[model samples]
Target: MRIKTVQAWWVQIPIEESRQHVSDFGRLRTFDAAILRIETEDGVVGWGEGKNAAGSAGQYAALVHLLNHEFGPRLIGRDASQITAIWEDLYNGSRASAAAARGHALPELARRGLTVAAISAIDIALWDIRGKALDQPVWALLGGRSAPRLPAYASGGWADSAGIGAQLQSYVEAGGFRAVKMRVGSMDDRPQVSAQRVRAARKALGPDVELMVDAHGTYTVAEAKRFAALVEDCDLAWFEEPVTADDHRGLAEFRAATMIPIATGESECSRFDFASLISHRAADILQPDPAFCGGITEAMRIAALASSFNLRLAPHLWAGAPCFFAGLHVLAAAPSGYIVEFSLGANPMIHSLSRVPVTVQDGMIAVPDAPGLGLDMDTDVIARYARQ
Candidate 1:
């Protein structure tokens, strides 16, 4: 079936409790999601979400513009079944060569973060359509079930800015979570202060719970090493993006210096970037966000590449329901030792968009078996939060 129409929506949902949730990046205020919907000629519609890398106003606008003006027009009237060809065409045609041929003054689109985000949304929507047309779950189409329920970790504990440890305590006491990820590097140039926060979180979490720290690429190589040394006794599950994701050599050096496994790639957009990450031995765990890393197709490729390098897959999910469900399918079909990152924050998009809420029971997320992404979208909620 040919793609009949493509539409994108920019939704900005205000955070209910606008407390200062400080990460290394800064305070997060709202959830901005660029939602894409693709319809085939016969009236099958599929949903997808684009990555809002830093939750900036410009980033959201760019994603919507890329999909609406650049990517959507190219996909209309094309056979939806040719997923591979469509992906390649979008990837190659959006690059510098195509821009030069078309005399477009726009920058090189292949490596552009906004371009990749748009492509990821379209690719995911196409996959959803494929799964619905074939009457199979996306995971089944990928290969088959590798796990009944994917292991999940509650990601929260953003430096208790209110001086009340209620957030972290609540997450730790939350019975279903087996592991929890806390934010570090909120002290900016001081890794020592961030290390102190890690120590406090470790103490509050107690023993037996797997604790992971995310620096959000705020630390330098020396600072990361120093922080690693300070927290060596806490027994961290992994150190996430201690250095900037683009610094492969720095990441490798940080990984070598620390005993904790290094997990990164949430900012990564393509398999080629991941190839560099793996080839350089930059990370022991690769966290590819399907919404950012060219959707399910490229994420699967990243997973395979990580597996070949004896690394593990733990999808980095910080988007809406569509992306979360997509991540579930990836985790369900991925090899063993893979974990799913479950956001433990207040996101109406994740909590209110789906008819059925996703829950982690005993630290395991039950895989949805319905066709496509298996999520029944809540249109009312979408309308309520749609940006005017």
Candidate 2:
């Protein structure tokens, strides 16, 4: 069947004040998600999430436009199973402009985020089509060598002292999540204060639970070191984004100073960006967002790079709809074992947008057994929440 139409949706998932608290960088706030849907001639459809963040609605809308007006037109009628060829066309085609723009260069982030998200949706759609064509699950088509069930981690977003205890305990009780991540670095001035928060969180989770800290790239090299050393005995799994993502030299220095392993690259959009971190030995683990990068194809390449250096590939996921599935496929396919960040604060829109809500059981997610990307988009929910 020929490809017919590609649609992209950008939605706002409302987070109430009770949900927001000081964490990692600033006060926890409502997050907006950029989601996509691709439809083909014979009624096959696939969905994806873009790398949209707290206040990036406009950028996500622009991405929807790019996919519909520019990118979508080119892919129509092309074999949906030709995922690799389609990916190369989009990535290589953007070479000149990608080189011209750099990291978080507002213009660059927009260009890269939109372009990457669109390509990702297409890649995911292609995988879905491939599964349907082969009458097998996407995981099988992706090469199923590992066990079907995937491990997950309880990723905390709330920051206040009053809120942290209940949220941490609930995940342990219900999710059976052995590893958990918490936010730190709410105040930039008091490095010691940050350390105290880390220590407190560690104590609350207990020594048996594997704890991880996310600074959200808010600390300076010196502050990161001071904070890490204070809780060096806390047994943190890793310190994530303590310094800004772009500062490779600073990251290398921080890695040298602290015994804690450094984890980052959630903001990164390509493998080339990861090259710097790997080359500098700046981080012990790499957290790539498939929605932010070029998609499953590029994520595989990034995972391979991380594997070469013997680093862990724990994806940074805190968005809506398609983000989890896209990350799931890559993590499942990755040679090195991986764990995904599961939010205690579940997005309400998740069930509405997905054909199947993820099969999360006791903190472990089971891979989808259906063909294509294994999940379908419930467009009815999309129509209900469509931004007016």
Worst 10 residues of 2 by lDDT: 100-109
Model 1: lowest-lDDT 10 consecutive positions: 103-112
Model 2 CA lDDT for position 93: 66
Q: Mind giving the per-residue lDDT tens digits that candidate 1 earns over 122-204?
A: 98888889999888889999898787787888887765534324556677567478788887774445777777777887777
Query: Each model's C-alpha lDDT?
Result: 0.81, 0.72
Best by TM-score: 1
What TM-score does candidate 1 get on C-alpha atoms? 0.92
Tens digit of per-residue lDDT, candidate 2, span 1-388? 5677777666655556775555433454445666666667887776766654532233467767777788888888877766776776676564534533542222333346667767766776677676777778766766773668888988873555555656777777777888888777745357776676667777777888888888888888988888887888989898999999879999999999888889998888778788889999898888887777777777778889988989889877665656677677778878865787777764555555677665467778877777766666777766765665
Please state the error at residue 373 of candidate 1 in Å.
0.4
Query: What TM-score would every model get versus the actual structure?
Result: 0.92, 0.89
